[model samples]
Target: MDDGKMVRALVRAALGRALRCDPDRLPIGLKEEGGVLTLQGEVPDIAAKRRALKEAAAVAEVRRVADQLHVKPAVRMGDGAIRDHLRDALIAECAFQECAVRVRDRGTLESVRTPIGTVRGTIDVSVDDGVVTLDGSVPSLVHKRLAGALAWWIPGSRDVANALEIAPPEEDNDDQITEAIRAAHERDPLVDAVAIGVRTQSSVATLYGTATSEEQKAAAERDAWCTLGVDDVVSQIQVVPPTAPTRETRTA
Candidate 1:
């Protein structure tokens, strides 16, 4: 077999081997060129989307995996609503307070500048279908990752195409993802991040600690996966309900 065909086969096999992806139901398509494989299709959820990308990138012949995968939204809405929400998310984000916001409206772009301070950079948001694309640039990799993570949080966001580039092009590592995950946990009211500890190794985040309930545990896991560069999430969180305090009776 030719090199191209062999690489494609290996990638497909890798995806099929991953147990969490529900390989039987996965309808993702693959394309390969110059050792780079591209994944294109709709996935059930964010977990499945990240899992598919990780599996495809793990192939020996695949040097990099391009993500074109979209997660199915829980609720359906028009493209305009998605654009507005994504734009608001960027503006309201404290880290992005210095960044300008723009949106694509009926082919015309509406620009919204922050009055707080000088514009460090801009984040252009455009939504097509359910996919949200972030363009322009940022001051550092941390800002880029934070913007990407926030985009994924918007409801009905099928996929976040984070194209935000760093102005000075800073180096990146697993620490970036770990920090992003921790920040996400802190931002999310659903998660009680005080008891949860985060550790990242090779793009995999392990969340270990205790949650008050099952829902909180799951929320913590979801926060980890939402961050960019997260290949997989290892959740070691235990659920322990809070106990009522018992007071000793005083004898008169």
Candidate 2:
């Protein structure tokens, strides 16, 4: 009825339109005052949280969106355990072993890994409660996305703010998404990188080819979605056991 209420209503309507659902149907909470909006709730996944923030921020009446939305982690863990696990995952990756990686503990930044070669970049990792924030610079978008994915995979990471920047910024497109997916698959032990093929158009990745097990097929698809820039994924991966040599169907 008043100006503030009207603005709030408009913002809700915009979010409803963007999400293609009734604002009431959306589980997230929205609070707006003096044009600053804060979103809070548990979303199903990272993608939904990101979509909510993007759509809410586009509202004409909203100044900025404070993201308090959290993804319910699959496994619960303490901050210390999460920090240790995340550090290990990053260090194990050959791409990141050359980068200076540090994790924040207590009041100081603790060194996790010293660069093996010339310093490629710096990666600062910090965890608060269940939220993980990645900052600093990386050499490529693939590295950035990989780091984000690794963070999200952590059992206690309720939210990940991937603020890592790429030095000598490269153009990001569907091709980059495809490359990242392939790289992820190569690193994933469950997936046969050569067996699962990726093709992307407009950020939608179509994964076709043959997989040894149903788990492998599913893992390959999940890897595609975890990569940055992948909006949607269509899994055309056929499960072919090692004994079954017959080719089923594949997407071109």
Candidate 3:
């Protein structure tokens, strides 16, 4: 064998080692001339194609590895099976793996609601042509990220696309505050029913009414401050005297 043939053999051997396959098992033919190596072979899979090229490049004496490896297709997954596999993958993810996250038989949606007042409603998990798409909304930024993370774990997914919105917490309006104040007044022992008027503006409030005692005045002020959206307080509350006396004229 000439020096060129020896160099080609060394290249093939190094590649076979990296691939963990027998050097003789690979039916790769090599052509070498003027330090350039030409490779011709049919690889069983894409892994073999990569291994062959890598081995050739690692050869110090060889200037180039010309790859001509044809790849063969192996097993094919059915559409329904692929979808089922992806569903299982999604379920295994830490975010959605728990018993709380459950998928419907139709696979149209998944729902997860936690005890922390966070809600995830109607997550649509679907895969088409190896691409996975998740559509849903959560109550906060944390749950939104959780939903996306869950989608990525799906098997056979070429790519995952998430379309989710975080819903803001609902706000209580003036009517609710008024109702709460009325309820508080009914519960308090010091408050005179229907005698106090609680006036509000954009949740900021002012208590301008009369009360029988100083304690009642303080309680009314406390109630007004606790109401939601009350920014500033203007207490014009007067404490009425329990007893009234007749007017008498006196010389000073």
Q: Give the Cα lDDT of each candidate.
A: 0.83, 0.83, 0.56
Mind giving the per-residue lDDT tens digits that candidate 2 earns over 1-252?
A: 987677668767876776678987777887777767888888776656666777777777778888899987778899889989999999988889778999999969988778866988889998988899899999999999889888877877898888999997988988888888898899888999998899999878899999988889877876786677776678899998887334553332
Clashing pairs in 2: none
Candidate 1 ranges with C-alpha deviation above 4 Å: 1-9, 20-24, 31-36, 244-252
lDDT of 3 at 1: 79
lDDT of 1 by residue, 86-199 (tens): 777777778888888888787887897654658788888888888888899998777887788777777888988888988878788988778878888888888998899999
**lDDT tens digits, residues 1-252, model 3?**
778978977986886787677887766778887767887765554335555666687788889877555433233444355556645544544444322343333554545323245434445556555444556554544344344433333333333455655456434566545554554455456777477777666655666768989989877765554333344456788898566544553332
Which residue pairs overlap in candidate 1's backbone? none
The superposed Cα distance between candidate 3 and the true structure at residue 183, in angstroms, equals 57
lDDT for predicted candidate 2 compared with the true structure: 0.83
- Sort by TM-score, best first: 1, 2, 3
Off by over 4 Å in 3: 75-252
lDDT score for residue 29 of model 3:
79
